[model samples]
Target: MATPTQVPGWIAVDWGTSNLRVWALDDRANILAETQSPLGMNAIAGDEKLSFEGVLISLIDAWLPSDARGVPVVICGMAGARQGWLEAPYCDVPARPSDLAQGAVQPNVRDPRILVSILPGLCQRDDADVMRGEETQLVGFMDAHPGFAGWVCLPGTHSKWARVSNGEISGFRTYMSGEVFALLSQNSILRHSVKEGWDDGAFADAVRAAKVQPASFLHSLFTVRARALVARDGAAVAPGGAVLSGTVIGAEIADVLGLLQPGEEIALIGAGKLASLYQAALGVHGHKATPMDGTAITLAGLTQAYHTLKTASERI
Candidate 1:
């Protein structure tokens, strides 16, 4: 039964595969209320088309005023995926991230209090790579560093490495390092060997080893269990997590090294721990990375889209 101090002019949403976040914002872009849900795109029942809208309303119904009509809801991320509420097609790369508003798609909604628009993700045809939510973070970063031109890395379950030049993403690559780490640590035989703690020395050394022998990267993964088994008093237990992490991330960096210029600027977009891990790993290879808060940048990107849409409506 919570209510905002003022009626929100619009809403901002970032709906991913596993989670959904919504914000009620005033006309000046200040947040009046915010909330999140586990009912992501994947959470909606496959046979129910109206499920997505229902889940959204259930989470934000309190924020909706009875007399207000068509409060704009700007959404980004997997909510626009092929399996999502409505498939907002990909906008090809080599394009300005802010231009995503031009291709935004409106989904069918029964609610009179809200009008939803989903932003299109970016794609690179020749490379056959695609991204959804990360583009918003990239656009937000560009809002802060409009002149930045270099590697922009966002680490997560599916990490993204994008190249930016003149405010447009020229190309990008995705890595399954985080997902791989999760699988190996949770599902594989390494599950028993790897634990919660991190060891910096073991991590840095593993990074060097993986970088030097990228071809044997797969071979190195098994050592997590082997190292744990052979050591006395479970000495290798704590370092197992770090070693596994370093190996995968190291190999990812190895593949991208050729694409980077000497002494180039690198923008690392993510939260504290993962970003710090990447910053440290990149440091091992003589690279310096500048970090930006993930949530702030995402909101900035959504804010940019809101303004763009607002201005366009004014023009019409």
Candidate 2:
């Protein structure tokens, strides 16, 4: 067995649909190096024997110190699944810190000394949807806000509104707002109609329109192009751009925020663009929003899972 000093360092990875992000951290959790690859789960589709071990080894080989080839590594996100290298089963709703830590680790076929653990996704019965990677964000949130208690909004392609009480994820819901927006803006007829640049003024105006008439999201989305062409004299050529941005985001906030009572704390997770948009919308509805770095949260999540596993191994 490699001595503690000889173990090199821990590796944290957030392997998702579109990209594979890897971080090399010292024992202190400070990042020493990082790398990314386009070998996302989505890109590997159609291949019957997609070898995650091969992808990981290739990435790690470039970064790993020659002497620390045996260092243990931990991974989160889609890497743990029936489609992934090994299935890390879903932890049920209202998952506790202990519950989150109780996941299985599978060794890579290419390297046995390279211990790997995959974080389990979340499943809730309140909705038909499921979340694979957002749970790590939640773990990261809990780690940052040790005693933080309240609800958090993780905005993304599939936005998740999670309720946490006393450091445990008590419940949550998922909205297909991002997916819907993508489909409408890129795949649907609205693709040809909208302008390319972002107009804050236009976006805000569209938000106001959605707020006043919630039911018009779908109907009003098409009007973006029409409004730009006929009403604004092509000034709003990016009609779909502003309209889709406002309608989908505004409508989602209106629908999800309804679950909260007066003065409920809301935390926003993800990149600045998406989180800032949600922050603006929440502000409009009289809610104060706190922003957390999505990447930081993901790293913290990996740390949490690692610590949990360490603790469990000690107990066993």
Candidate 3:
């Protein structure tokens, strides 16, 4: 909760497919308070009873200023999608992240105390790829590591691998490794074999095998089950999940390796188990990944946008 003395200078939001996270920040962009909801764009879009403004007000009403002056509410992610609050058009690649705030679109709202702006996502025409929330995180990372030029990997359901030169994102590629893994482990035949528990050795081995014989990825996936059934080994049965994970992740990395420069640095932006997994997996290929926290990067990005927009408005 934010006390009166800690009145937020503005609000930062990361509204994604399945989650909505909000943060109250002071003039210096320090977080005062934060909250989240499962009612993301997908949920709100499917339910007629839910309205974007209504949901936002419900979550942040208490944080709104008592004065008439409106507080800026800077949002990133799917909230700017075509089906979101209002379409914040895509900013094409070779675009600077700090400049994304200039493309932000404001939606009409009944609230007098809140002025909202949704940041535009990044897009590539030739490759026909797009990203929403992840761009903001990249902005934050680039801000922290100025002059960085290399590959930046954001691992998720639809993992993104982007190339940064100077300070602009030249291009990127997406992989559905996470989503595919989920379907295979939960909805596909592998569900029966996949179990809870992790075997570092099994995972590493699967990664190496995938790298060596990338063409066999499809067939190797089935081995997660076959190895469990025939071998009856504790390592195979208990860590089937790890093996499956490694297989897909390894395949993703193997494909992405072609895009990397011979000795270029890789920035792995994420946190928790997923980031750790990627760090280790990349390590297997003898490429050390520099890890960064996803949340912090996102907040830094939103903060960056807020300041950029604010400064522009102030100049006018």
Candidate 4:
């Protein structure tokens, strides 16, 4: 539990589809108290009885002090989607990363102690594609690496590759690579065949193979199933999983990685196994990636939005 004196400024939240994380932070963005909940956008959409603010308040209301008249709250992620707490709208691509708060909106709330500011996501109208939470992360990454120009990859359920140039998101692509991998591994026939963890040698081999035969993607995926069936021992299942992961990831890499012009480095923005996997996979293509912590970048992004909006509001 955080003492009342610890919360110096506003609250930060990353409210996604499946979960929401709230952080009580000082002006320095030093977290005072952090809390999480299963009340995500999906829960709000599925449960007709729950309002978005109702869900949000249920989780973090206790952290608010009675003395604060209206503490500022900055939020990111799916909470800004059309189906979220309140629609923050989307800023079209080829937009500056700092301009995310330009499309910000506030929720009609019952809580008198909180002033909520929801940051908008990014959209590609032609492709009919949208990203809800990652834009904040993008801003955070740019904040950390000022003047960084490169191909930045946010590896996740729906991985995103953004071309950041001159402090702007020049353009980007979203791949269903992670989401597809989950479906294939958990719900499909491969479920029984492969488990978590991997064989590094097998993973590297699979990455190389997939990178070569990008067209024979389905055939490559099947090799995992085949290997699972023929394996003499249980040891091969992990490698089978690795191969499956590599194949899918490689296809995504093949799809967009060539845009990496000469001397343009790769910024792999994420943490844990997913990011590590991306780093290793990029290595196979003779590219070195600067790995970053996704959580830190996400927090930095929300903080940036807060300051931007705060400064703007003060001007008015």
Query: Going through the candidates in order, what is the number of backbone clashes in each?
Result: 0, 3, 0, 0
* Top candidate by TM-score: 3
**Overall lDDT per candidate, in order of appearance:** 0.87, 0.76, 0.89, 0.84
Give model 1's TM-score versus the native structure.
Answer: 0.92
Better of 2 and 3 by lDDT: 3
Better of 2 and 4 by lDDT: 4
- Give the TM-score of each candidate: 0.92, 0.87, 0.93, 0.91
Give the per-residue lDDT of model 2 (tens digit) for 1-316.
1122323368888989878898777777877777888887766654656568777777776556455445657788788767776788888887876686686556556674467877788878766556788888898888888776667899888889988878789888888899998888888877886547777766777767777888877788778666655865435254468667988888888777667765557888877788888887777677778677898998898888877777776789
Model 3 agreement with the true structure over 1-316: per-residue lDDT tens digits = 4443556799999999999999988998877888999999999999999999999988888876667458899999999999999999999998897668899999999888899999999999998999999999989998899878888999999999989878888899999999999999999999987767889988898888888998998899999988867874555354889899999999999988867886667899988889889999999989888678899999999999999999999999
Deviation in angstroms for 197 in model 4? 7.4
Candidate 3's C-alpha runs over 4 A off are 1-4, 229-238
lDDT of 1 by residue, 1-316 (tens): 3578887899999999888888889988888889988888877855465487898899889998788789999999998999988999999988786679888999989999998999999999997999999999898888889888888999988899999878888889999988998999999988876767878988898888888998988789998778767789845354788899889888888777768886557889987888888888899988888678898789889988888888887899
Give me the runs in candidate 2 sitting further than 4 Å from their true place: 1-7, 48-50, 62-70, 228-240
Residue pair clashes in candidate 3: none
Whole-model lDDT, model 3: 0.89
Evaluation by lDDT, superior candidate among 1 and 3: 3
| RMSD (Å) per prediction | 2.3, 3.6, 2.0, 2.6
Instruction: Report the Cα lDDT for residue 193, model 2.
Output: 65
Q: How far does residue 268 in candidate 1 sit from its true spot (Å)? A: 1.2
TM-score of 4: 0.91
Candidate 4, superposed: residue stretches over 4 Å from native: 195-197, 227-238
